[model samples]
Target: CSSTRKVPSTEGKVAFNFIQINDVYEIAPLEGGKTGGMARVAYISKKLKSENPNSFLVMAGDFLSPSVYNSLKVEGQRVRGKQMVEAMNAAGTDIAIFGNHEFDIAENELQQRINEASFTWVSSNAFHKKGNSQQAFAKTDRPVSEPLPPYFFRDIKSVDGMQVRVGFFGIVLPFNKANYVIYTDPLETAERLYNTIKDSCDLVVAITHQSMEDDIRLAERLPNLALIMGGHEHDMRKQLVGNVWILKAHANARTVFITNVVYDRGSKKIEVMPKLLEVSEKIPSDSLTQVVVDKWNRISSENFASIGFDASAIVLEKGEPLDGRESEVRSRSTNLTRLVVKAMEWAAPEADLAIVNSGSIRVDDILTAPVTQYDFLRTLPFGGGLVEVEMKGALLRRILTSGEENRGIGGFLQYSEKISGNRDKGWDINGLPIQDSVSYRVVLTDFLLTGGEANLNYLTETNPLIT
Candidate 1:
């Protein structure tokens, strides 16, 4: 899982290194301790810094929400990404941007997490909304609140007394659309920032939380960009558009990218080289960061114990890997989704069928055998009770159709195996076709019944079709 590459000697070049990771949710090692731990990342970061003093650890975004720890209560208040910020602080993260998921918490809680961060934050397109006004998101933890800047510049000196200035800007996709946030056009904002900072810096980099297509478009629009470190996709990707390179690492720090840049003073040219490094058992965890990670793990275990659950107890031992990956669950039914829906049906035996939104499956990793209670908790972090309801078949058809249309998103439905068919072919309950006049019993997550799912607001308990 590790690759070795040689960087041409930095004899007369101004050289620096960047350790990049994105879409990370878990601070501890994942997949039964086989890969990815913030303490291990900390170890890597320290090693990189020792090799090159100008080394910087950068995170593209999406670290705050959709985590089991975020759902737990600590000292009577929701943890709400507090553990993530603490882990990152200890991991030596130098720069970060706001991912859409960062707004999943309330504004106050987000501000608290921001205030706790020791690194710099930059965003070019996201803003804070207040009534009819919009402004830059700021850190209020200090007496004098510090507003996050649109971009930042870091000046580094090579070993031989040569200096280079690197400018960085960040932008996130406006997908979340939290009421307190206003998102501007990403391309426009990136172009504007690049033009403003180009003359002052030797090279410019972009940290983004967006789709690969959008990242390619951004690269095409700003051909002068030296590099783009991006997130929002769980898999690792590397591509070149024009002269710029876009790099993304696997989610949960399963892998990371180490980018090396060399600036030639006489030629006025910049050369970029990037390497992929797997975070596995080969890399040792940093002693200091492991202490912080262990602290949170202990807290999580205690909370689970109080609820009559042993976090480490093995729940199942299947040889086949369970697919809880975000891309797969949202687009189609997988073994993990089927297991969830089956469990729902078992909970409500009287119900003819059961359904749950793919968004409920939050773990974006391939779970191996010997799955533990902690794994299930991570999979369904925003836990909800199952609700059995009796509704007209006509209403059921509409719900299924809506879920079909919501493909490739969290709101897409994963239902029991007893139900089948698409809109064109029509739906069936068990082996029989659905009849509009028939009243069918169904089990569903409380979130969907409360009309919280996307494009299914009509499925609420107050709807006339549901009794």
Candidate 2:
């Protein structure tokens, strides 16, 4: 629905600015010399809005999930979701679309987050289960007690007194259905929303958290989409793909794109001049935003206190790159990944081998200092849970061969035992390579299990250890 519509006046031109950012897991304080925390994002957003009266702030997604604060506190309780809501409210984000990770919790949990959020939660793709048995048949259904309303539609008021109605249609990632169930065809959903709002609104903006390719395709299909802002790939990119302007930011609040657009009333066209502002080092953290982040950190520290441990320099050294050949950290796998595998062994005793993606290990340096809970969180910040799968020894070899062929540094299985061949032989399991038969038990994170960034076809064949 249009909130308000204004007619254009021939007297003067009006300028409007819009800001977009993505993937702030929580209010994290910038450590080391790196800045651009949520506080800094808040600072920049507020400053920009103050400078430009007709400015609106929007975030693409990934506000929840993978967050220690949300997982430990907010999943079932109102407080978990409310913290993000409060943070976003403080940051003054006018609209937010759901990211794939947002569906990590139950639908009810998602609804609680939506309720707590003062800003608009727009999603054109997500829909309620149609049949009575839909939830029953759902692989990841959590039994939601309440359902949320449809996506949001807001009318943007231009400075020139010209009423430009802007519609925000949000779409989360489709493949995220692995851990949790939310189904939709992003392109079709976008078209449906655009068709409904195209005539009513002067501009239709698709605020999606889908992959960059999907966003680009949607823009191509739906010419009415003025802008397609996205996340999930964790890249900072801006381009005019076909008729729509696609904008994205790097993960964890590193950059914010200030996009300016001129809507030509005569031609009824939209032109976007996008500016990607690096939030790190340049902007100061907002104090008010810091309070929220600090609160979350305190709670996170208290809940996951067991994970924290001091590195006395025996186990690993800081800044050392661990590779497959070097035993520096334990060959190939970084000291960080090795520690993660140790954690996996402790968490799951039945698993024979523990595999983790290098991408999941975001920490550039080794663990140092007294080692607070934050340190562990930063190491595996993606919040990816573990998954167990049974595969044949031959199949394992094939997986490794595929990984080798693909030049996968991370997805190649790091085994506890030499399952396929011999680790002493340069970590290559089999001279015969991967076979299709011999069954073996393999453990991996949910991210890789669902075919996240890595191409692991073996995951689809095996049964999941945990849902």
Candidate 3:
């Protein structure tokens, strides 16, 4: 707010800056307090708003679930995403799109969060399945068409009073879930919305939470879109496809993308320049917003403390950064998963091996030095007691083979050090071939015992001994 962002003096040109982030889970700084606090983001917002006469703060998706803070009990109930909306409101967010995780919780809870937000919200193909007419859920102020308005528009005038139209639309991954909501074809919906506004708007921008492949396909199909601010993947990426530019930042508010749009009135030309901002100590905290963040942080810490876990205290000095990112851990080996499977083994020391679903490991971040109680909770937010079972070698082989078949899924197995396998090929235990007729003891979560996986349902059916 104090100083203006210096820009080259380009005559007959005016600028607009777009500030964007996605997949934020933590309200406070992560990595042992080294990166990503909402107060810093709030400060940057104020600075960006002052620097550019026209600007927008946007989030693509996945702010509603898979969080350690959500695991905290507030008044003896799940505080799922109540903290996120409060912090985003303090940060002064302008708009947001619905990500797949938004549907992870109950439908009523999501509607409650929507009503709680102070910013405008938009969506693509997100509609209520019932009510006879397939009513759209997102209540937009400026209604465009059926199934909820697909886009929002605003206009700004240059120094000479020439009006410029800026239009925005949003689309997300087509994660189909029955009964409550529906996700129509993403590319088709985006194309239709762009066609409707292309005639009137000078620049059309998109807010999306889809794969880069879909982003590229959408850009190629609709060449009129100026930029696609994307999410879903934690990796930061920037690419130009046809006439459209695509951008994404790291997840958990660790990174952000700021796009400066310069429009020249004389040449009727537009140029887009994007910069990646790493949320670090360089950005000062806005004390007003920091107050709200601290309130939630303090409450969360105390909640964890009551359960014999000091959320902020150091637990272990990690030798290397444990890769627990969603995309990576769900598909491959990670120290966090290994540590978790080992813990399961400790509880059932008599078992031959320990195994659990990758989806069960939801902390979704790298564990650096001085790992804290919060870090462990983040890794296993949905806490449950471990269970042990006895099964024939044939059943064990079948269970592992099924897990390998569904590779890269959250439910994929992450087993203990004693067990190894390629889901598609075969499995081995303790450096020896499994005897078909012999029975082996194994440890796993009760969820798995109660039919969490397709083949795993047999565990409960047989009613094996709970060691």
Candidate 4:
């Protein structure tokens, strides 16, 4: 017999794929149904998983609250994240991490959503708090299959018989700490987790909700990481710090990241190929997911109709591409802001002027299609109506000036038609000369009459137009 030995058939590489989405809140298509529906997202996931059996779907976090749907109530209980959990379950999300917005709702509600989810969720640094904790909430109808483990481990054996192991952990950035939970340093927590799971796994993956800068710091501290996935930044980002790789996607499901991992058993090398996919009309919708989405759309419309606004009714078409994104609304005068203030002015036509905080307007994108009543609710979700209050021109000037000076604040002032002048010019009330003692009927939200959210202080209301 020949002395030459036959090479082992199992010396090939194993491939693992990951589908990542972060900061997605809207389950339905945004922008007049042009893009970004959870149905399409589900379709993409199913296609990817079909292509590669070793694929995993993930959301780095922030899907629970902050939508008009989240404000709905069923029998006096908040539907805070009931819809979100259902949609994500249909979307095939295998795992997720907590983003800062996850804390925007009450802790009990947060617990309720977490308890309802079917996927595995982990937050390495988050800890249950003492006193008035989330334990008071009722258990979800379908409890999670397992408690959220700080780290998740998975082993893969390729068709050719090559073996690979991936260990995953999730970390969240600093958040509002609203009597819910405390957090440990992400790097420290990561180090502890790595120590416990390192020897058993071939590679480490970090699914983080921290800033890219913090992720870089984490990379420097823990050099053994193979991949890092991030959220909280609203745009796509990718960077390689040393040998560690970091990847992120755009907010609102407008963009996603798909990473393919190849591990070579012979050379002990790992190759990562990443693709940035746009969530657009090209992606087809899964029938089951589309059905769920349609149901939610009907529910959302009915809920808003109960509040006396026909959510499906088209109000305005495109005059121009209106900027409604949070950054623009919170920071500057945008076309969307101008249009919304115009509506406020129209709503209170009898008043001399109308004023609102920029923060009160919330849909975060440029509208290039039909505007509906649901879009209005997305802009102003807190349910405050217009109130006409009489105040001295001096107090009006003070409120406007206060709002102007405090630019970049959510409560920053945005005025209705014909109201001009700035804090620097002493703000001409109604674009007219101000008389210190003269009374003017100013239309604004009742929230402002109680407190100048932008620091208006109300300055005392003498005459009231209660209608």
Best by TM-score: 1
How does each model score on TM-score? 0.89, 0.76, 0.83, 0.77
Report the C-alpha lDDT of model 3 over 84-166, residue by residue, as the tens digit.
Answer: 88888988888888887777777677766777788777886676666556766753323543233568776766555566677
lDDT of each: 0.89, 0.62, 0.77, 0.76
Model 1: per-residue lDDT, tens digit, 345-430? 88999999998998888898778888888989999987668889999999999999999998877789999898899899999988
TM-score of 1: 0.89
Give me candidate 4's TM-score against the actual structure. 0.77
**What residue runs in model 2 are displaced by over 4 Å at the alpha carbon?**
1-12, 31-33, 74-82, 130-152, 158-160, 178-182, 306-353, 357-373, 381-390, 401-427, 430-467
Tens-place lDDT digits, model 4, residues 84-175: 78889988888888886787788778888888787878778876675745322223455543446788787776665556778889998765
Candidate 1, clashing residue pairs? none
Residues 92-166, candidate 2: write the lDDT tens digits: 888777776676667667655666676656666665454442332111324654333245455555556565666
Indicate the TM-score of model 3.
0.83
Q: Quick one: ranking by TM-score, best first?
A: 1, 3, 4, 2
Candidate 3 backbone collisions, by pair: 359-410, 363-378, 404-423
Q: Which RMSD does model 4 reach against the true structure?
A: 7.2
TM-score of 2: 0.76
Model 3 residue 217 lDDT score: 93
Cα RMSDs of all predictions? 4.3, 6.5, 5.1, 7.2
After TM-score superposition, the amount by which residue 265's alpha carbon in candidate 3 deviates from its true location, in angstroms, is: 4.8
